[model samples]
Target: MKPHSLTDRPATLNSRYNRLALVSSPRHLALLNKEDADTLVVICDWLLWQSAVTDGWHCVHFETALIDNHAPDPLDMDIMLRANDWVWLDGVDHTLFHGVSLGRQFCSTAQYIVSAYYRMDLALRKLLSEFSCREVTLYDYWVDRYLVSPDLRHLIVATVARDMGVHFDDQLDPVLPGDPALAAAPSTLGAPPTGWHKLAKQCGLALHGYAMTVMVAVQRRLRPRVNRPLVIANWNMVRSFLQSDPADDCQPMVLAPTLPKTLNLLRRFWSANILPCPYPSVGLTQQEREQIAAMVKVYEAHWSEPAEGLEEAMRRFMRASVLTLDNLLPLARQVKSVQAFLRRYRPSRIVVDGVKSPPLSIFLELGKAQGIPADYIWHSPLAPQNIRFDNLGCESRQEALVERCLSWGKFNDMWLERIGAACSSVRVGNPVLAKYTAMKKSGGGRDVALLLQLVPAFSDVRGLYLSQYEFFVEGVRQLNQLGYKRVIFKMHPSMWREEYYEEIARRFELKVEIRKHGRFEDYVREADLVVGPMVSGAMLEVLASGTPMVAYFLKPSTLDSTYFDGLNVQSDISRLGEAVTNNEFLDPAVVLDLYCDSECGQSPAERFWQALSRSPL
Candidate 1:
């Protein structure tokens, strides 16, 4: 069955149910994103249209991924008002997380995933008791919070999975030890997909970051006041911010999600050597902690115990739930906390990172209200994506939100067109990558850098809308057949095994080596040609660094209209080997067009600082 589209849902609602909650169907969830304004408009438009025709029953929509902790876009707010909605609940961003049983205790992808929503469930019940909701109707699917029945026990209508013959399972199934067993290191290449669940196991040190999460939560807790600073959102922005010249005298105070994995990456800044200067944290404050603790207490009071083996795990899950969902009061407290932090620190400017958490939009909202200069950053490239730029996509909303933008060179014109010439845009090649790609020395060897993504979403719909991991066996097969002897497999940080390259070599019988340790510049310095999927920002940086590139996509239908006209790109999943062997993407002239809009003679870091420095204090 096709995923639910605007025209695909049932035309009318059943009058039997008065209070209805329109939870995002998988199809709708797949199409909508909290960060994209146009996506929000499209989704809200559909929900409002549903509300328009419905009878006496008042309806609310639950996106589950959005935490609209502050004022929304006027138009989006208007639509939601017309639709009369709930929201993408805070701490309940189920789209990116799941509950995993680690030993006797349980943990989630982030502290705010499936576990917390369960606690919020009881809170929701308590709140619902105040209303006259006899039997609430839900319009969602099994893909939402793993346990979503208690809140909407009336009816679950319009789930796409049900049409496809998948039954809803409510069991809080614990992840077994080595349950997603390692893919057989393939002796001779005769195997099928190892099933979806098995292929979706946590790669490496997923849970190990818990300690760091706590440590940072305590050590760099939010301060009442920070020294002269520039406020940035998410760890990715911090990564880019610190990559510039320290003498430039810019201190970055980052607002990051307090999650284990994120905390682990943030802790690495001490010795990163990439940072020319020090940065501060945006972790929870004492008040915020107290509020969170109280929320946990109230949430736990409701769902105190669980069945059998899930006792301790369920308790942790509840704690984790409040850590993620829309408990309103605590989130409002967090907003106050941010307000206090901003008032005290008074960052020279506020930057809203679009690629990071959606609530970070709060920063932009606050910036606009307080007369502080706030801007947005695309922070990456967009090609080989499901989004079609030449035809339609929702990125233009970002261009409208900010007065100025810091973007990749190749995409500047697109943003200008999307937002119009009124918005000033600087074609700053990704500063983080620019710092990494610095010191690139020309090499006289024939070696290739093949990037491997974790989940290839175009090829597999089960994964999130991200692509990076497809190459490896297929790419190596192609390159080796093309007589390229030396190849380096740069593993994404999310990969679990340290010896993953060795595993690849052993499994696929290739002459490829893994460059496990080194900065990106080190790898770039050693390679003659950079070959990877076009969907990555790093590849663009490689092109800007005067290196030739060949970008691979799964198929032509999945390819977006890339930036350049004569760019070296091939989209043939069936004959990837032929595409690589024939040098279908080999070009030096294409690199000229790539860096043209990506960067100027000035370093990206300098350019970014200049963009932020546009409106002076």
Candidate 2:
């Protein structure tokens, strides 16, 4: 049947019984014929359109079915109706399920329920409830049928609203009135004249500073006055935080920082206002700042730093108010959103972690310009003045530049002087390292393990393939050649669908095991050594266990950009054999003892909290 647009569907209320009857029998196919199939198509189309328009969801037509094979036996028509109502609930993508599952409770219950809706609703509700928020409003139109229902709509709406602690308002009003030129003319009539003039006025900045300073100022401002501040620690930092009493009220919010999308989603749902620390505009350059300021609200001339013509722009156009410790340099594309959040929340402080290079310095300068205090949580201690040669293989030009600039600018001394000059103090800590030490000693049994992470081959700029199946095949072959037996080949978690690893294992006639369940540490403990490209986390964990590590650098060129540079990056598989025979491994005592020492061993969490406590907003 040809696809039909839902906008043309006529509005009419059909009872659940009638709708179910129409869809339940094979004769319903004739109904499509009687109404030119367009009617049914229109109804379906309209329903999808309404849902999408109401909620920020995308829905697409799958296939027309005379009878749902997945429908329950003895066919409870009521349940079928409820299931149908729920098929598009919350605008969740439903392409995964082959067909809808119908049951008896759906029919007689009068509580029109969709299994998919309930599942998603429960999961989302539970996830939101864990966070401290006044309320969460899920605006979507796909559930219009349920919303219009007298019995089920009210109950579901009320239940969801109460659970989320917020009002659930479904605006059925069309985003754009009518259609085409007629609908758009009304909006244009009131639109501002001279777009270029408005654009010019929008892109202006007032102040600039070092990125690190902005981060510190922001962090200082965000220090919780009442309860303990939430410290976000990944699996690697959880144990360390739990062991140390950083402060009486400090709460740990354990989360992996790797998933940017998940973090963005979480940030959207959070209620707390987000404040972005301004940094010196000098690092951003005039053109870059102009581009940024055009989209965001630029706060001007608040602070002065050593950089030329540098300033900060406070963005106020974010969908969610999120106080991100992550750098805003890469997210220049979302400057409007960032500006939105800043404008709405006007957050007092911005907490910044991992500000080691120019980006960090730029953020700090920007925060200072914005008049927002910044607090920095440093993972590694300040590199000594003589340690310039230490970073011999860093591929990032910005990193190299920062090192050179700081050296020329005497930034290390200035930074230390600034640390003492500022109201707050610096913290020396490595939360991940601490967690690894504790987990290894805890005697956690082996379960799932990541054996190897294949590094992609790099060529010219913009030519790196993320997946290197061929390299992985070569690595596996090399491992077998070295008398290594019974090794479990674990592909990166992100590449589960790629079956290349599985196929290669089969072809090699190797008796290697592949794991798919349980804690990754279990595999780490069972295995003797971790062999892969520059996956620092695995190496760090294995080092904590005092297990041997053999890193196979894909190429010397590839290692240039990795953190492994100047830190024993191996180029050949032969190194693995040499390390095993030579009993070469990083000394846990030396590494751990460095952190254990009074100079660098201080708990970072404690130092961070103390700094926050001392900051004058």
Candidate 3:
């Protein structure tokens, strides 16, 4: 049956059993038929609207159903890997960013829209299967409104319904008083900066790029034949260098698009060869703009339902791909600028966090062209098998960009080998771990630091809201029962939802301290025990700090099975207090040996430098 929109006929709540009504926007409850059902399945942060709905309605929350750990979900990854057709146009390969087929980037950007469509489809199917319901009535404005772009909302909702064979109701009628104008399409491609703000940013970037280029020229003249390794530094690299005391010989010139405050500190103390590679607002040539427009047309018109299902949705997804091509013009500009910089100065080597990123890979490719070998430092903890490393289908194609990978330790090296990463792996250890190893451990106490992972609501990270809810509400309740008098709630560095944490704290009536700032190491040293409910590299860092750590999760993850294999990983929130009490933490030395490979004589920074020196191009 075809989907139906609202009419003058008012929809009334039905009390029939086995009937389910999934509500994305519940404001117009008067218009909802409730599927002539006994249940109301509220998707995405249902807790906020739970009290408003009818009592005794069986509700399944969106977050609770899908467990997200910030890492790529298996389903999401499968969706990404399933498509090879979207990038092909006519006979030639349209799957390229600059001169390379950046298949991973293209798929990932397409997924920003398509994944949401498929996920909603999955959610509906799952709900029907669990409830044993024949038909599901959808009251959704969430897709229509909350999506990053406006044009894709109706398309996604309609596509999802048809794909699932569910009776789709477009929207509830008798609009809520203050609801946003549904017809208004805000610029799908984000609004560029206007007036003085735009001008200032452009001028700043241009000046910074020129200044860095001049500095490199002067440095080349002053110290001929010096081994100047150019570092395409991100925050992680800057933080690593900041923590470690690098030798004079190991200093690499830093090149970043934007300089965080920490980089300024690094420049003052460490090396002054820091420059901003002007990426944003790069002046694109007319030819490049025309090329992007042409590519957009091809991608927009192209549609192939890969054998992976979601056939009807792929068409809209292809159209959505047009929006992401905005990056193409900027990428071309970046590549041109980088080529000039690399050719002029001729850095001895290129150092970056990873070779997988499209932007970072540009540096690697350019460096390779100029005979400058690239070295990628293992920045984060190696995630476990299946969900992360396995089934990517693209890493094998991209790994050749880097000449060598400076790994964290044996586990990373082994995993890299297992995954068939083309680069040779060297266990140079991590500077952050080395520093953590020397830190004075906190004295035994009941105080616990709970690391929170709070992803933005309705984002690609599925079930993230549920993860936060369980981490805060359920986790705090469990801690209180255990008689843990003082609990410090450490917000994820990327988030600052103190108001949400405070609200949860007030509800629990527990003595909780919400910490929005402070390094991960600082939290480990201050608390007697570190408990991270979400998957994080900091958990590995906690292991190196000699502090007892409990990896808590609502469901078993790759991290639980692999990294913290023998350690205390509690999936049962109720048993968390017991696990904390038992405190059978992993031995720091063994953990260090496996993950960090710490050296007694030399620092990790020094070790990495030595490894780089040993590995000749």
Top candidate, metric TM-score: 3
**Each candidate: RMSD:** 16.6, 25.2, 7.3
- Candidate with better TM-score, 2 vs 3: 3
For model 1, residues 390-484, the per-residue Cα lDDT tens digits are: 10113322222355556656555464454223456656655655453455555434556554443343222122211122245566666666666
By TM-score, the better pick of 1 and 2 is 1
Candidate 3 TM-score versus the reference? 0.77
Q: Order the candidates by TM-score, highest first — what do you get?
A: 3, 1, 2
TM-score of each: 0.50, 0.38, 0.77
lDDT of 3 by residue, 1-617 (tens): 11111111113323233545555454645454444356555444333333333343344454333443345455533334444344545545564545655444445455545556545555555555555554555554343213433334444455555665656665532223233423112333457999999999788766656665565556556666556677675666565665544444434566645465333553553353333333333466787677767766665556433323454445555555443556566566767777766765567778877544556767776777667888878676544432222112233333366777788777777666655556777667777665676775754676565545533222233433344455566556666666666677887643234565575566546567888777776777777766664345676677777777776544423222555566455666546667767875556667667777764445666666666453431
lDDT of all predictions: 0.41, 0.34, 0.54
What's model 3's lDDT at 282? 45
Error of 2 at 263 (Å): 20
lDDT top scorer: 3
